[model samples]
Target chain A: MFFLSPFELKGDIDSVFERDPAARSILEVLLCYPGLHALILHRFAHRLYLARIPLIPRLISHGTRFITGIEIHPGAKIGKKFFIDHGMGSVIGETTEIGDNVTMYQGVTLGGTGKHSGKRHPTLGDNVVVGANATILGPVHIGAGSRIGAGSVVVRDVPHDSTIVGVPGRVVRHKGEKTYDVSLEHGKLFDPIESLNAKLEQKMAHLENRVAELEKEKRRSA
Target chain B: MFFLSPFELKGDIDSVFERDPAARSILEVLLCYPGLHALILHRFAHRLYLARIPLIPRLISHGTRFITGIEIHPGAKIGKKFFIDHGMGSVIGETTEIGDNVTMYQGVTLGGTGKHSGKRHPTLGDNVVVGANATILGPVHIGAGSRIGAGSVVVRDVPHDSTIVGVPGRVVRHKGEKTYDVSLEHGKLFDPIESLNAKLEQKMAHLENRVAELEKEKRRSA
Candidate 1:
């Protein structure tokens, strides 16, 4: 029930309309807005989690994710200046600690390795940028001022002030990456099945190439 | 968000103190207070969904479920007199059409078979009773006056006035079988791993019996 009345929503809407650069009109947003609903519910549920109520708080968080497709775990500790854009299927795990000035796009999973039981999941240092659907699995640490590229599956710890990209998220840059507040909003909300299909296609292609190479060696041996 | 006003909540608390059964003074329901939150949110979101503002409606529904354990889909057409008990991981598919006087318990999924493209999912007629974790997949029709048992996985069309039970659900009772509307709330939400473990246990027991029979046959032959 985290929805405010039109009277109370007046101030919030006005602020968004006045400050947020992306908005053109309030009517448009009122007419068609999904993010607004998610953001508001998350805020309340997150507050309840902070209050330390058992079962009900967790249930509320669970309910929010199920309806909105934005998965923010009740136990995750997020610091100041955190923003999520088109945040569907973005899973932030329990025992994960997020530092100040961090921005994340859709499908980002700060997950733990499945087998281990207690106090698993990542610890993100200040000013980290996690891109779309990037999976930072295991109890790893991503240091301050690091940029994780889209679709990266990072298993290891990242050093401070580094840029990571591609599958397995290789470091692309290590320039002076300062901690700054930035909001991410764009095409990250679209269908993730496309990216999944692409990964499968690439794997199939690699397997085919290996098969071809093996056939060529057989022919030479013959 | 859709949280109660502090003032209104105070009144509710006062009423509970003054009256024996103010709203929810029952010991069982008081212990499981979160169910009330879930039920209310589902009605609101479902109402919004019926209004045809698709995205926001779904977002609200998701947000509600995220906070609660209940999981009701936005597009699923639920009728009046519909009751949900311990509504956790209860995935009603996009095109599911439920009728009046229908009730379901936790983990019930009116799901689709495969990648359903057109007219996907089942259509449950009026006065139907679906139990816990019962997956009624495909575009099948469960006729009016039917009772689908707990943990049933129905794929085919069910006739009117019948009772179905077990995996690949078979009609265990003929017409005129009494329907039970006794609501039960299990503490645990629908955990897939837990369900898998239960199934595995049953399968293993069956395998052990088969092995024992095989050993006995071999001994007799010798």
Candidate 2:
């Protein structure tokens, strides 16, 4: 039976208070939070996996997934003070490497692109916050202090202190602020599609105005 | 004490066979499929909810969600043979209404806009297939035989026999193919962003050629 170090337990609890404003008490965090439960269970399963215990580790992982709705593969290496808030439908693949002080919201997938074998999942650096329903696929590196916006599908590497958003996510902000606070304002992020559509509309209006001017010139000549 | 009707059970089982070609035996489906487990549990919880049993229905729904990773609010009304393949992260909101023969994949959210109180969730018509991670938000109506593509976020009503895709979903195909089959070819779907980029590139090429022709004519005049 694998047990959590007292330091790890304290760090996990402290991280919850630091991240979630709604976390009222330690008892509530311990009992009510599925994310916390999942992480604790993962620690146990990971220990079993490291010990070369075959089927039992996977079974434990499966049971944890069923209970928590957060599927973290037993083989995934997670660092200290890792927090997942409202972590339903979050899938961490076997090869995923998560660094210290990493926070992930619900429906975040650290997955493979199904192209290559071995080390296919994402490697997240320290203090990375991934937003809701954001998919970081393939063996991409998410550098430290980066924030990935909600509903973004990131398939490429993100540099340090960057903000990523949109499908095939682009870095909207890079290396601006050192102090990283998790931003839930995903709606405020730049939408490339909407921007393109607005540009097209402007072009159409310009063309129409030019056509009207040409018509007026033709009539004046006549 | 709410139990499924015999017809409902048979229909649910039949749908598994129809949709999943790999489904060989009834026993395997009954025991192994988490999707089926969720649906069966929802039937019970939904009945309790309709009966106005306070707290019990919600508790039942919570338990089912915990086990299946598919959260269906007890207040939601789902029709017969509603199949959810790889049902993890699939959320059905409280006021959502789904018609018969609706199939949904994993990570699909039939959710609300959170701006309204009553009837705030989507209403999906018969023979509607929602693909993986597709979010149909608000009190929108999805017409019969319509297909929502993978990762599409649809906020408005969809017409019958239409195929919707993209971030703020646009109908790419409409009024064609009466027979609706669940299309997993999400990669083949028309990407609006890519199309816009291609158009821009073509315009630039055309302008470059026109500029070269103008320069040639000017040189001749000189």
Candidate 3:
């Protein structure tokens, strides 16, 4: 059994209401939210892990995973007011560290790439929002207030207050600007691939026109 | 209680061994493998759904979701020999259809757009392989032998024998050719964003060189 402070528990509950529009009541959040369930379980498991209690901590972690579908390693360190919305298939690695007021959507992975030992997972700063199915691999740092777009694969460090979108994520906005609301509207995010293809089409048209003019000039001279 | 044919049961069990290299033995697969569990449960639920049993089928679906972390609506039609590896966070919407020998990875969503009535989900053809975290929305048809890459969001129809990649997926390989093996190696898939960025750099360089030459020629003539 794990003993949790009422203040900390209230803070976690408050976070769900602050971030999620779908949260109807405190009773509903308490009974239905798997994210909150997993967090509470992890806190207990983490304490056992810190106490050097071996198999029990791992067993509790495994049972929590079976129930919640969210895998949080007992060795990971998570701060206050952490909220994971629809947290299915979300994985937090052993060496990972997450800061306060962090929000993550479903299928997000804070994972490692190689088999190297120490500090092999990501460290997320305060107020970081990671969208659905976003994978952040290796020992990278995601700065405070950064928003990672949905379905993005990030393998490198991201700066503070940046908006990261696309595969092998490129920093699209870094002006410390905030947009829209806290709720993640994945469809509204900028389509970088579409934008690039458009630019490519424009350039190709210009080159074709220039080549045609050059051909006509040569013909006239001849 | 739901009765399943022994032949269909064997086929489903065999699929785990065929598709996933991690399957050690029959006992391991039967005890583990949430995909197999979810599929078996879905078959039972689907039978009840066709019989027009009201809340029980939906209740079974909900219970299955709780255990497996894979949500398959009772109204969805699935095919034979289908395999879902690491089935967490996968959702199959109502009116979604699948063909024989189709394989799906973790976090895949066969979903719909808008609140339209009939056939709002995707229909996948035989031999289609959808990778991890890939989302196929709307009532689009995925042609036979097509491979969808990891983390790709596809909203439009894809042609046969095509390899789709990137966000809002583009057909990267449409030659009716196959590559590597069946098991999805997400890291090895063609990165269209990187390729486009390289092409853009080359085009910009060529344009800059041509502009410099034209300026020098004009200066000489003057």
Indicate which candidate wins on DockQ: 3
Q: After superposition, how far is residue B6 of candidate 2 from its true place, in Å?
A: 1.6
lDDT ranking from best candidate downward: 3, 2, 1
Model 2 per-residue lDDT tens digits across residues B1-222: 589988889999888988877788999999878899999989998998889876667667667778788888788999988889988888787889999988899888776543234787799998888988887766889998888988876777899878898765788888856644434344458877788788777765755565566556557657
In model 1, how large is the Cα lDDT of residue B186?
14
TM-score of each: 0.39, 0.65, 0.64
Task: Estimate, for each residue in A119-162, the C-alpha lDDT of model 1 and write its tens digit.
Answer: 56788997677876566755789988787777555667888877
Better of 1 and 3 by DockQ: 3
**Comparison by DockQ, 2 against 3, better one:** 3
Order of models, best DockQ first: 3, 2, 1
TM-score of chain A of 3: 0.87
**Lowest summed lDDT over 10 consecutive residues: which window, candidate 2 chain B?**
B179-188
lDDT of 3 by residue, A1-222 (tens): 455688889999999998888999999999999999999999888988889875666566657878888878788899999999989898787789999999998899776543345787789999889998887766799999888898787768899888888865777777666654742554457767778888778877876676676567557657
RMSD of 2: 6.4
Interface RMSD of each: 16.4, 5.9, 5.5
Leading candidate by lDDT: 3
Candidate RMSDs in order? 15.5, 6.4, 6.5
Q: On a 0 to 1 DockQ scale, where is model 1? A: 0.03
